[model samples]
Target: MSRWSSETSKKFILVFVFLFLLYGCATAPVTGRKQLILVDPQTEIKLGLQAYEEILKKEKLCNDPTINALVQRVGMRIAKASGKNYDWEFKVIDKPESINAFCLPGGKVFVYTGILPVAQNEAGLATVLAHEIAHAIARHGAERMSIAMVAAFGEVLAAELLDLNNSRTRELFMAAYGLGATVGLILPYSRKQEYEADTIGLYLMAKAGYDPREAIKFWERMRQAASGRRKIPEFLSTHPADGKRIQALKNLLPQVLPIYEKAEHKYGLGEKIPEPHCR
Candidate 1:
């Protein structure tokens, strides 16, 4: 009788989880992939704003007018292409050693000065900015957090289902769950998000009148920059392999090139980004 009750409880929990997931289903833009995001947009935007404030407080903003203007100009164009009514803002961070850029929820974007050389020109900059903007538009951060929340809920459910009374058994089960969830689920979802962003970004840049093909060149330069560095294997890394990303971009060009050609005002490469003067 006890065994039957335990089995019944497990089945009930599974059904409840499935129903909950269905209630939280969302479709990603551009790619139209179904997502199970349990968080609301308002909450995500609020959290993003708080983090944005914290980051701005710690990072030095670039005072160079040219760099600031360039970032804003490119960022706004991409934001407009996204068609999301986010309160978009772009700023340049004065980090010469960090070749990184990111967009927080609600369209807050930051570009590090170090990446400008690799970006080379307006089109290359568009490639980078568009990709980051796509992440925000897709609410990837919120989705990731929701995934973590679900994983935590699963752990709690497992404990109840198994009736893990022994402390050692509970510890081992938690350890295994954490490893399995991270490697098998979370990491793969992260890489999928990266790929989805790349696909969406190509369309956005093309629509914004920047050449979509420039994305390939920019990534090639990135690959060259990291040529000698030790690379994390794709299965373990949060991002897809650079070579794979480049190939995926190549595959997508045929679809996005027409969007660029049809844009009312094509900038092609737009303007060359000047090298910053030594302070």
Candidate 2:
């Protein structure tokens, strides 16, 4: 079957499922938004843990003791505040040119050294950590996998019902879910997921005693860094900076500031931020 023909059938099945929920869904934590997910959280976490281990084997870990300590410190603080019971581990990769960070399911975090300069200070790093951690806490990855699974299943059902060839349908399944064994699969979050991550991340950073304003500053620096470079690779593509993110943070500032203030009162917020030393 041609790609066009396969996609047409896939779209038709998707529309049918859209009008009727094929699977019972769950609501996102903190945001309380309904999500059409079919995958179990346990299975999702297992996939994440497996993928993270594979990634670590292919990537070199940073030898800088100071950087490693800082990542651990901030990561632990945010995890503690998130109040979600999960095993957490943090690692700093020695990639000096790749500006990226991600947190897999079950609280595993990987931060690239390339992002250190952009982060600038501990608070900046906290922002990135908090954001990625928020993704894991909210099970956004599982939700995405669930959506893909439903699409794939829909295709299979249609093929079986209509007595069509299943090979093309299988290909559509991979395309829809992006299941290639590429080195870096850049999974772009939905707009809703991005906003939820921002919101929960702000609260986490605040509870961890990091200034909420640093999150905005970190994003601004990230935007500047991206513009200074040539083009971003497809594997590293991020959401466009529409200024809405910053504006949203500003609106949420009032809610998070108090938490930051409370944490600071308990743990003195006058520690000097150290300068970054490249290895």
Model 2, 116-188: lDDT tens per residue? 8877877888888888888888877666655555556634443242221344433332222223333234446
Candidate 1 residue pairs in clash (backbone atoms < 3 Å) = none
lDDT scores in order: 0.73, 0.70
lDDT of 1 by residue, 66-119 (tens): 888888898889999999988898988887766777777778887888888989
What lDDT does candidate 1 reach at residue 148?
A: 56
Residue range with the least summed lDDT across 10 consecutive positions in model 2: 169-178
lDDT for residue 116 in candidate 1, whole number 0-100: 89
Q: What's the residue-level lDDT of 180 in candidate 1? A: 24
